[model samples]
Target chain A: MDSCQPDEKLDLAGVPCPQNSARTLIKLEGMDSGAMLEVIIDDGEPVKNVPPSVEEEGHRVVEKVRTGDRWKILIRRREE
Target chain B: MGIYLDNAATTRVDPAVASEVERVRRSAEGNASSIHQHGVNAAKHIEKARNIIAGSINAEAEEIVFTSGGTESNNTVLKGVVSLSSNEKKHIVISAIEHPSIIETARWLEEAGISVTYVSVDRDGFVSASDVEKALTAETVLVSIMHANNETGTIEPIKDIGRACTERGVLFHADACQSYTKIPLDVKEQNVDFITLNAHKIHGPKGVGALYVRKGVKIAPLLHGGEQEATLRSGTYNTEGIAGFGKAVEIAHTDDVKKMTELRDWFSKELSENIEGVLLNGPDTQRLSNIINLRIRSVDGNRLAAELDRRAISVGRGSSCSSSKSTPSHVLLALGMDSKEAEESIRISLNKWTRKKELGIVVKNMIEIVTELRMV
Candidate 1:
């Protein structure tokens, strides 16, 4: 759960759906293959929409944990 | 107490309306179509409700045909009108910014070999009546325009468009789902053949609404069962929901309209002054008073909505109709706003229950959040 590097954090802590996916996409584009991204979001539609959208974009969602109303999602950038 | 700024999506049922609904439900009311004593009572209640809803919109009770909700009402009008018309009169005109129900229904009509012209809106989201005039051909059967936009609160010039349709001998239908209870609507004044409104927008129970069909106008029915609602709409009437809807309309007509409008305007002025880069979406003078659409530059509306929700202030991003879709608002795009600007748009709608203190908190929290997010 703590595998992500401190400088590699992508905090989407208070963002909504689609935007979370969008920001995750932008961050993934700038990162090297196999780099990890830590995403924090509210648990609702995003919990359902984000992982699939990320996977479809060729990234791997490694861990998804629900802590109260917030969700911590980890995505690993895939090799092209 | 969580602030509810999503009134455009749906409103909490008023206590009075809820009580009326409960009373009807607890009675185990017989079917309005049945001939029993309980059925007679239920039928009487439904008739009273029909009258109340009709009087609120300045239409006859017979013109009000109850439906499940706005989507069904819109579908009924668009499909019903086209189905009733001859193949020669296959042309239909609709605004580009109409609700998905209308736009999608028009799309279906297009697929069915009907000619459809989508009239564009101005920068402020107002559809020009002259554009409708220019689009009308002798083969045009109907013109469907919304009375007020759900996202931007822009009120169209329905009366002028109605007059044009009248002169051209074309049927006119206006979707008044968002504006019916908040604004004054008169079928005669607008001269529209059909008007659609939903109960849930006005603090009434969900699952119930009415479509106003002008007397003597012929249209095909969307559903067939028990020959209910003059055979235009057919289903076992939702007695309790209709009762709540009637009570809500009565309350709206007598009490909430003036108070909510005042609260809406006050909230808009305060929010605009407090938040920098806030641009109003629709016309200042012509929009509905209960809705305020503002674009906060550089702050993603989805993020802003999440932050505001975290602070217990519940506003919405884009129209509730398009909330699940990932794209920016089509209505804003039609109004000539760039995609980025559309993504920054948030809709705040007020109701009678919205208080000044709550709005103050909302404005304060929104200003702080947007400021902080912009810096990031």
Candidate 2:
């Protein structure tokens, strides 16, 4: 499951809270349904918040991995 | 990863100090004003902390008044001094680069019929002694200047200003929140009538601070209540927080200040050499050893802060106390930086706990991120 490749790489690493979520949503809006987006983040609070919020917006969290202090979260767009 | 470079804003409470605070909070349950053994014990803690803080700053323990923090300390001093005078000596002089607490307090005094002269800083963010000398007037009752700037970390010429104030028979007050831990401060050497120190800035608990009022200065009380804090500031004492603050101060004084200075210098040198368009904001030698303000051209400060946050490198822009606002730093502007450059500036402050490896990581990540951002 962890070996699956992402359709698109979205490095949100180094971005602060709220802005990261907002940017991710904007990116997802531009993609087709079922298109995968890999988001890398270092802020701990946003890692917990962004995945659930993105999933609620009809996206699927394909992977969530804690690599050291950063999190690699892959989300697939499901619908509009 | 997750390097905390924003020590100027606030610091992580030292574990020992935190445990001390917790111990007081958990086991010592007594009001200092209560007439019981527990109260006496609490009062003893407060008194001991006061003595430690006072001794560190060369002030008598009785002259130290506890307050909520630096802002309250500044407000108390500004309002207290102004209210005590009804004569023609109603003029107050402050630097253009003082914290908002001092700036707003001065404005409030202006509204109350007091005259205010904002002394300007040089291009290096230093308030010259000559500028301060020129600003002093016959009616100038008090001269309030920050010992160190919160944004640029530029140390002011408080000793010269203090001497001038003494010669002119006017009072001198310094807000030393940013400089208290990083530099050696003695009230006698600085010749300051009042000095403010905050705990959170020195790895201590928040909501607690001390103001050093020289023994003979006559200033009205900001708060009216029971005769606490020598009747200068009126409120129940924050015994636990105060004790924590004292412990923090003791640690800061005894800790290797020179070693921290060397580390900060190395960080600054590394960042300047490795990063492009990284402009140092204040006087190279006159600024505090722990703080380095850098301007990364072509990137907005908000964006840079966000990017750094993503990299797990914590830094700040302008003042941490004023972080919510997106305004260009007023201190940078006072030092002749344009709004664009000011908006691109970020401050990185380091403490003793900061590791060299962490700073190396920060520099590498900062270079990569800034390069990536500039390309975009």
TM-score of 2: 0.80
Each model's lDDT comes to: 0.85, 0.83
Global lDDT for candidate 2?
Answer: 0.83
- Candidate 2 lDDT over B108-202, as tens digits, reads 98998899999998988888777888888878888999999988889988999899889888899999999996777899998899999999988
Tens-digit lDDT string for candidate 1 (B1-376): 6888999999999999999999999883687665444564566567778778888878976688989999999999889989989857599999999999999999998999999999999999999899999999988999999999999889999999999999999999999999987778899998899999899999999999889999899999999977777677778889999989999888885367677767778877887788878888888878887788899889999999999988888887898978878799999999899899999999999887778888888888988998899999
Give the TM-scores of the predictions, in the order they appear: 0.80, 0.80
iRMS values in order, in angstroms? 23.9, 23.0
RMSD of every candidate to native, in Å, equals 25.0, 23.3
List runs of model 1 lying over 4 Å from the truth: A1-80
- How would you encode candidate 2's per-residue C-alpha lDDT over A1-80 as one tens digit per residue? 53457777777665444435655665677788778888888757768666866766678888889998888888878865
